[model samples]
Target chain A: MARRRGERVTRWLVGGPPGAFLLLFFLLPSLIMIVASFRYPGEFGGLAPLFPAGPGEEGGLTTENYRVFFSDWIYFQIFLKSFGVAAFTTLVCLLMAYPIALLIARSPHQRRDLMVLLVVLPFASNFLVRVYAWMIILGPFDLLFTRSAVILGLVYVHLPFMVLPLYTNLEKHDPVLLDAAQDLGATGWSRFWRVTFPLSLPGIFSGSALVFIPVLGVFAIPEILGGIHDWLVGNMIKEAFLGVRDWPFGSMLSLMLTVCVLAVAGAAAWLAARGLQRA
Target chain B: MRRAALAIEALAIGLLFWSFFSDARYALAGAALAALGAAAALGAFGQRRELPHFWLWFASILVYAFLYLPLAIVVIFSFNDSKLAAEWVGFTTSWYAKLLADVDMLAAARNSVLIALTASAVATVLGTMAGIAMHRYKPRLLPFMVLTPVAMPEILLGVSLLIFFLNTARPALALFGIEFDLGVLTVIIAHITFCIGFVAIIVRARLAGMDESIFEAARDLGATPWETFRRVTLPLIMPGVIAGALMAFTLSIDDFVITFFTSGVGTKTLPLEIYTMIKVAVTPEVNAVSTLLMLLTLGMIVVAGRVAPDVLRGK
Candidate 1:
């Protein structure tokens, strides 16, 4: 009985602080954000009081935020554009990372560690610096505030995330499979297409996830490198909260973004699981 | 075969580097280099039979060039003796000098270091406990709570925390007759919240690699759980904890978006400071600070990598 009590005390002692902290700091905030999405904007800024007003007064509770979101085609358009940019970023990252990750994975052991480090080295720099680096490169060409600039910036910032996961997945494949394909009179293109490419679908899925989800919420890239028309949902969210000071509207946008991201993550997990089942 | 690969690989890297400098100075030369590089790359791609995976190496070398050339420009132009970053007329250290003289930048750097130090220290303790708890006891909600912060979009956290801080602090503090708002302390707490996930992941990975018997042996020796952890487990996972701490330090100092939201008006981190400067104007002074920040981050992460190789591997 004494020892069991000691064990129970140890579990609580070990788990209680972080659990309490995350619940308060992370989980509570998320719940508040959800609640904020439903509350009306204050007369000045932020949300109005949490309680419903004396019947005739302004509504403290509202579906107006969500109504505003769905009633406007602009919000849907921004969401669509954000997804388009994310898909473009993910696709480009894969094209760039695939060969580099493949090569790093296939390299001899002693050299592999060094190559992996090299791949991640550029990514270690400050995020703004990486984005700012392109401003210098593109400024002379009149490309600084173009849509191309935003897409390029997004791709460059996220390239390492794609490489690391793809490399991790690619490194685990059996060499004999490739060798057998080669011995069976398969051409290099056919071998990769038929065998290697299919095998790396899992890597592609994970790398795409790492690249895609963050691009949806990215504000700084489009803010710096993009023109006025390059506004994604992120910029609108930033404008809503910071510039326009519409905290309720910002919460609604964030709630939508969170839902979209969770859906993408869920679908990716489901597809990945189904792919594994088929395999 | 190897010689052919090396020759073409060097040529590709050279052509890529050639455009980085000459583009602004001589657009013709830059175009020529680009055309020649593209032809050689295509030729290598079309003739993969002779070279034997030579295109792979060539493709990877070009990718590395793409990865690095922009960063190289940032570092190089920091010392460029020009007001604009277009052409490198000469080398000078004036930008670094200007950066050092700037009071706001220095204050921001001080705040960043202070926040990183405090947050990483606190996060390391909490994260280590979280790691150990999850590993040993396999608690239910703890893992979800710990890992979700790392996986979710950074802006979501930033936005939610902004709302939470704004809503909770004023009213909660008013009950005690104390006023609070978003600032340095809020930034620190936000940093700690996000950082705990990363540190926990690293520590858990470290714990995962060890044999279970060591802890069991300590427990079986008539020692209490805490006593066993002190003598056996702590010494064993010390490197991991240190690595986690270093990583958390770098991450906290490097973070921008979350800090941007939670920092409100007064608190200025290095990244936030850089954001304001970059927005106002493009200056070589920004480059100088960026180069120094890069060196600091690289230095700490390198040391951390040396201490625990798996830290680099993300294992």
Candidate 2:
């Protein structure tokens, strides 16, 4: 009984503060944004109060914010563009990162560790600084503030994301399988195609998802390198809240973005589940 | 087959060097550097019997060059004597001097440091406790709860926090006779909110790896829970905690999006200030500032890696 009481006290002492802090600051703000999405935009800027101004039977709730988002062809185009950019970035990252990850995974122990560190070393620097670095590199090519620049920046910034997961996954692959395949008189290419690639699909999917989701919300790179016209959903959301002062619209957009992210995660999880079952 | 492979490798390396010389005056120098690196890479490849693939080595070298090219450009331009950032007009240290003398930039740096220090300290404690609790208690919801901030887009979190402070937090604070404005305090709050998750993830990994027997031994030796935690648990996890704290500090100092949303008048952090500077023009001064910031963060990561190498690997 004493031990049970002690455990309860320790649990509360340990878990209580962080849980409450997250609830108040993290979760509550998200909840408020959701509530704000249901309201109208105020004149000039900001969100209108959720409650009606007058004391009557009139309700202030409206779906117009979401309606505006769904009805606009321009918004749809931007969303599609964002998705395309993210997909392209993911594809490019995967292609570029795969061989590098494999090389790192297969190298001598010390060299492999060093190569992995080299991949992660970039993260030690500021992301904005790295994007700024790209700005200088893209300057002479007449590519500054262009779509290509943004794509290039996204690939550069997110290469580690694709590489790390692929490395982790490839590291876990059994080397004995390769020997077995070769022992069966299979050539190197055939062995890899038959065994190695199939086993690394989970890693490929995960790395793609990792690169894709973040690339969808890449505002900094786009804003720095791609100019205003190349704005993604992330840039749009930022403009809505900070630039345009349209909180209701911003909140609605935020909700949609969250939904899109959730959908991506759900799909990835489903695919991973299926892949695991097949394996 | 060997000759064909060698031809392809030679052609690829020659094209790589040729492409560098296509644009800037420094391109030839860059090409020369690439040649030197290729030679080194070839030498290393020959020495390593385990690595049988030359094309793989070549491709990996190209990727490394790609990764470091921008950073190298930034560092090189910081020493450029000319006003044009992209051009190399002999080396000079004037930009670094100019960066040191900038008053407003210094203030922003100070603010960034203050915020990072305070936020990381608070986050480290909370995260360590939460990590311990999650590990020891096995709370069902803890994983999702901690990971939400990490998984959410920064802009989403920033805008949400912005809306909250403006609409809810300010009014709530005003009711208690405290003036609430979005400034340094709000930025710190926003930082801590996001930073907690990184710390929690690192600390949790460390906690999970901890030897269960040590704790059992402590208990058997008549050490009370608090005493055990104070000596055994804290010492065992100190490296993880320090690593977590260093990561939080680096992140808080370097954060831009969330800070941009949450900052009001006179609350420009280093990244925010750097963004403003870059938006105006690409000057050598900006490069100098960025180089300094990069050094600081790299130093912190080195320290963190020393404390616990696995912290970086998310082990």
Candidate 3:
């Protein structure tokens, strides 16, 4: 009985700090953001209580913030654009990364090491620097301030994120399966479609999720490389909260973005889980 | 095979020479290099038994060129004597001298170093503790708590923290007659908050690979829990802790989004400085700064790779 009590105490002590730290800083901040989203913005651009009277009040309880976002064509277009950019970036990253990842996985161990270093070195630098580099490359050729530039920047920024996971999965894959398919007179395309592609779906899904979520909230790239017309939901959030001092609407947009991210992450996690089971 | 190898090498050298003399036109040189690389790769595949060694060397050189060309340009242009940027008249070390003499740049560098060190240290301690806890205890809520910050967007976190600090703390602190600017402190806090997730993930990977029975054995041998941890677990996971700390340091230095939202007017990190410079005007000084920063980050990553290659290998 004494040992059991001591064990429980040790467990609690061990688990308490991280659990509480995360809850307080991460979970609590997000919860506050959610609650504040429903409140009104004060004159100083901070959140006011959702009670009797405030600066941004129309009566008491109101859905004005949500209504504003949903009704406005500009806001709706930004949301659509953000989603479209993230999806397209994910698609392009997967397409580009697949071949490179395959090549790395199939390479000798020493060469694989070199390839991995090449891929991750760019990742270690400041993201802003990488985007700035792209700005230099694209800005001169009149490629800056274009949707294609935004897409290119996103793809460049996220290619490694997609590649790493897919490479991880592919490295562990049994090459004999591919060999067996080939031995059975299967063509290269069919062998990949039937065997390799299916086997690597978990990595593909997780990589896509990783790429998609961050791309959605990436404000810097779109701000730097994109045209005024190519502004994303993140830009809108920044403009609303910081530029226009409209916390209520910004909070609403933030909450909506978080929800979208969560929904997508949940679906991806489910798909990855199913893929794991199949594997 | 030797002839093919020589041919590939000649092609690569010719393209590189063309890149230098071809008015710094990237697309043309890139196309030439790409064509040569493809040809060499095809030759390598066709000759399965005896691989063309020069082709391999050529491919390696091509990879390096592709990866380092932008950085090389940045470094080289920093020395251009002409102030009419991008027009190289001659080479001079004046840019480096100017960079050293700039007080604001020095201040930003100092602030960046301070924030990065503090955040990395705090995050490392917290993340190391968290990693040990999650690995040993297997608490039901561990996964959820760990994944929360990992999944949360930087924009949302930054905005939310801004709101919390400004609205909740500002008034309360004001009543207590305390004045605080949301500059370095806020940036450090934001960095630490996000960095905890990264450190936790890296350390968790290390902890997962550790043998739990080693700790059990230590306990069985009459070592106390703390003693067991200190003797058995800490040493085993020290590599991970170091790797996590290094990663956190790099991340804290590189972070811009969170810093942009949380930083005060006077608090400009190197990235912020470079960003403002780029927006105002592109100069060789900015390129010089970028080149230096890239080299620093590359050095850190290389050290990290040496210390914890397995961690980097995604094992």
Candidate 4:
């Protein structure tokens, strides 16, 4: 009994440092951000008292920052624009990825390997490089400054993320299932809709989530490829904190983005659960 | 039926060839011929039990072109010699030589190497610990803790860290009679913060796959917990730790968005340097630098693949 107790104690001692480290660094920074968001910025961007004073006070607990974001049409427009870009990017990636993924899944082994390498090679390069490559192709022809360019860049950057998962899921699907569907007198469309599409949903969901979440917070693509009108919420937050030095407002925006991302993720999880239940 | 399809496909191929080599009119003729041939082939093949294999082959080529053409252009242009930057100049190694001699590029390269090595090492240790603790202890806040760093957007994390330093740390350091400029140290800290999550996730995955009986067996053999961990568990998880470390290194070296937000005026990493150059225009010099970076990353990924192909093999 004593030996086992001593072993448990040793395990705790061995494991204690990591847990404490994460708590201090990861958890603590986020906690500080949340607290700072609620408080006002002090002299020269320092943290002021938690609650400053009443309306018109130099430093006070005010919901004005939050209210400004919510009440203003511009902030909402930026939010919508970011959402729209993410959605469009996701859709384009799905369109481009599905056919390629299908082809990869169906190809002979050597060819499939080559295709997979091609897909992963671009992905392994710096994300900025790939985006810059697009800028080169699109610029001087009035293409870089367009909204479509931003979407194209996003889709290009994320295509592998979408394709890899989809290809894996599709590759695992039994050929016999499709054969059986065809033998049952189903047409090509029916076979795809009934057999292939349903089996690929998990990959589709995961890929979309992976692409959508990051693209939502994409900072550089729009900044580089987009004109003045194409700035995302990410750019807005960056500008607020870095350019304008508005910490409270930036914090508020960050909090809003976090809430929105969680809400979308929750919705996705709920939808996925419903789908599994139906299945 | 097969003969007709083959004949039409050949005609289409001939037309495409002529279009590329001949005048605009011939090109148009070629495209029309190819389109008609393809349509007829699809129509005929659609009636058969098996869908046309030609469609698959054609689609595959198109997909490959889409994925590779841009990269091909960049790689090709990197060898160009003209200052025009757009038109294909004669191929030369001068740009590469220039890249070698560029002081700023070399400094950025050195900084990238330093940051990647230091950040990967620090993140590996911390991440391995976190992974083990999460696996062994099952802490109540583990999920939230892991998700906090992973889920928060890069911009948010960057700005938050910036705020944390400026608001909290800067003044406190001044009171200690030390003036700290946000330099290499700040960049390294940021890289470590982000890299930790990546390492933790990879290592955690490896830990999940590990059998619990090994540790139990070690205990049964009268080994102390530390001895068991040192002797048995460490060897088993070393691959995972190394894999995580490689990932952290790649992420740190490739990172631009976070580094941009946190790095000071003087601490220019390679990605940041390339980004600024790109903001002006796509120079052949930038392309040369990019090609080198791409080669390095590809080499690292190949090594990583050999080390842990299973991690990347599945979804």
lDDT of 1 by residue, B12-60 (tens): 4566555556745456546556654655655554654565666567678
lDDT of 3 by residue, A51-165 (tens): 6566655333457788877787887777888899999999988877777787788788888887877877777767766777766665545687888988987887777888889
- Model 4: pairs clashing at backbone N, Cα or C within 3 Å: A52-A60, A52-A61, A53-A60
User: Which residue pairs clash in candidate 1?
Assistant: none
Where does model 3 exceed 4 Å of error? Answer: A49-61, B1-67, B84-87
Model 4 has an lDDT value of: 0.77
lDDT of 4 by residue, B58-85 (tens): 5444555566666766777788787655
DockQ of each candidate, alpha-carbon based: 0.80, 0.69, 0.49, 0.51
> For candidate 2, lDDT tens digit of each residue in B82-179?
89765666889999999999998999999999999999999898888888888889887666667888877788889999999999998889999999
Best by DockQ: 1
Better of 3 and 4 by DockQ: 4
Docking outcome class, model 4: medium
Clashes of each: 0, 0, 0, 3
What DockQ results for candidate 1? 0.80
What is candidate 4's TM-score for chain B alone?
A: 0.85
| lDDT of candidate model 2 versus the reference | 0.83
Error of 1 at B217 (Å): 1.2
Per-residue CA lDDT of model 1 for A173-279, tens digit only, reads 89999999999999889988988887887778888888899999999999999997679988988898998889989999999998999888887778767755654
The residue-by-residue lDDT of candidate 2 on A1-279, one tens digit each, is: 998899799898998888888888898999999999988787768876667778863337799887888788999898899999999999999989988998888887777767888888876788888888888767876889888899999999889989998898888888999999999999878987898888888888888888888888768788889876678999889888878888888899888888888888788778876766675
Worst 10 residues of 3 chain A by lDDT: A52-61
Best candidate, lDDT-wise? 1
lDDT of 3: 0.78
